[model samples]
Target: MEHHAPTTEFLGMTFNLSNVLMITIASAIVFILAVVTTRSLAMRPTGLQNFIEWVMDFVKGLIGSTMDWKTGGRFLFLGMTILMYIFVSNMLGLPFAIAIDSELWWKSPTADPTITLTLATMVVVLTHYYGIKMKGAKEYGRGFVSPLKFLFPFKIIEEFSNTLTLGLRLYGNIYAGEILLGLLAGLGGAGIAGALGAFLPMLVWQGFSIFVGTIQAFIFTMLTMVYIAHKVADDH
Candidate 1:
């Protein structure tokens, strides 16, 4: 693979540098945008502020759709953070990328398993934490065996499955899209014939990829809320 995650050692451990950089950059961009957008309040929003306020309302609606506002409102920050970060990270790779040897300096952070899995783990952990907080430990534990004790093992397995699927789903889609874009770029590098061949296809896929990225981010956000609802709902 031309685009491989760069590794570096730290404190007797190793980490993927490319993934780390992308994550950090994406986070900083989102943070800066948030601050800039809301720096001042106006009677009528304009430009960045208008767009950001719209995003907040859209995200809040998504949260409300999944669970009651009383319970889901607590995760508004988490939901918003994940949605904005993922969307921005996904778009980051749509431009140019630089990859040398086993080091990639540009790409979507979610394209790396480490980043996506860590995110999925955080969401899962929070769901369990909120579950225990909302309902007693005993009650939350009993949820695994709800309706029937025989289902306890399956319920336990579901937790692991959810974690795997949640991360892999985003990683798979974004990584595949990036791979295709990379191949298209390679083709265009050949000559005039190559450019002609790749042009229309590249244009089509680029537009579709953006749509795919947006949908994947939304799906991930929705699933986060759903997982939380399943764990923390009173009926659970």
Candidate 2:
């Protein structure tokens, strides 16, 4: 049987209860992790602090590769926050998905196209905002037609294409992973013989899902910085 996400109407708009719940949980986990990792300032880091510092360094490198540190320094926190939130969100559905009375109450938030597309839209909007802010409105507008006026249409189309690719790529990977995981779980639950048969495949697929989740998060964050760099950096 196909399970549907519970829904609620708020402010005359329908919302998916499962998406909302999982998003909140993922955000809270990321927030708590940030707090716990940075609560104590130390000259010499250890344990969680060390791990977070390394992650921060990695984010910094990602930003640096796209643009100079001078231009990308301000985005470090944003990049780190985005990377952590998406990674946490991706992992939430891996442990287990919950459904009550045929209504799903728990799953990965990014598995929903609405959530992924919203994120992509936000990133694209931020890029435009930062572009205009950094380059001035006139200069930023000129970028669409730079090198040749004929390229304007292509440039306009690129924005839409970028948004769709960024969002849909993430949704496809996560949704498919969750679906396969659920199937494996069902197979395992059938009987002792089925359980034994499904056990190894389930374990292997679960591990692979974690890897896909991590890669998806990294790709999204990296592309975000790349888009911002194109706007903010002077050399296109």
Candidate 3:
């Protein structure tokens, strides 16, 4: 938790170097996985294609559960992409971490508030954009005052709340996992008995972190769909 992300300047602006590097790596990893998963393009769809198709079906089901396929289908890519990217990014730093004193050179991008918050804000903004685009300004505006006029303020507040919760939930869980792992890593440096004592816990904790990463990714995806549904669902 005390580890500071790497910092650097680019074109006069300061940036978190560790985050930029991890984000780039995560993006590349996702792109490569996507290419590999779909490269064969088999009609029968075996191996990677089969797995990709299964993911597609999972996304489809997730969408169908929330809204019409027409509305939700368009977001399947967004949902799937976010799910994969966040999951992979969350898992990235679990196996190992690079640190020099208190400076963290590499870690999970999703564990950072900036990355998670940016993603949350972007998704919320898109929901508003699509809501107005699909339903027109008049109908979208009506959403704010639905049921009663007093709700306008609450509706406005809801946007910020949604964004904060979406991002913070992911950050909190991943950060906790990272912090616990760091403590365990410290235990490994103690003595022979400490090393033996910490080894099994570290291994078990890492596996649990993977589960945490996956659950957080899914939760983020599900909330994204819910937020979108609130904005774009015609019946809502």
TM per prediction: 0.95, 0.98, 0.96
* lDDT per residue (tens digit) for residues 12-129 in model 1: 9888888778889999999998999989879888888898899889889998887889998989988988999999988888776788774788999988887889899999999999
Q: Which TM-score value belongs to model 3?
A: 0.96
Superposed Cα deviation of residue 167, candidate 3 (Å): 0.4
Task: Give the CA lDDT, 0 to 100, for residue 60 in model 3.
Answer: 80
| Collision pairs in model 2 | none
By summed lDDT, the worst window of 10 consecutive residues in model 2 runs over 39-48
The local distance difference test score of each candidate is 0.89, 0.93, 0.91
Worst 10 residues of 1 by lDDT: 94-103
Off by over 4 Å in 3: none
Cα lDDT of model 3 by residue, 150-230, tens digit? 999999999999999999999999989998999998898888998999999999999999999999998998889988988
Model 2 spans with C-alpha error above 4 angstroms: none
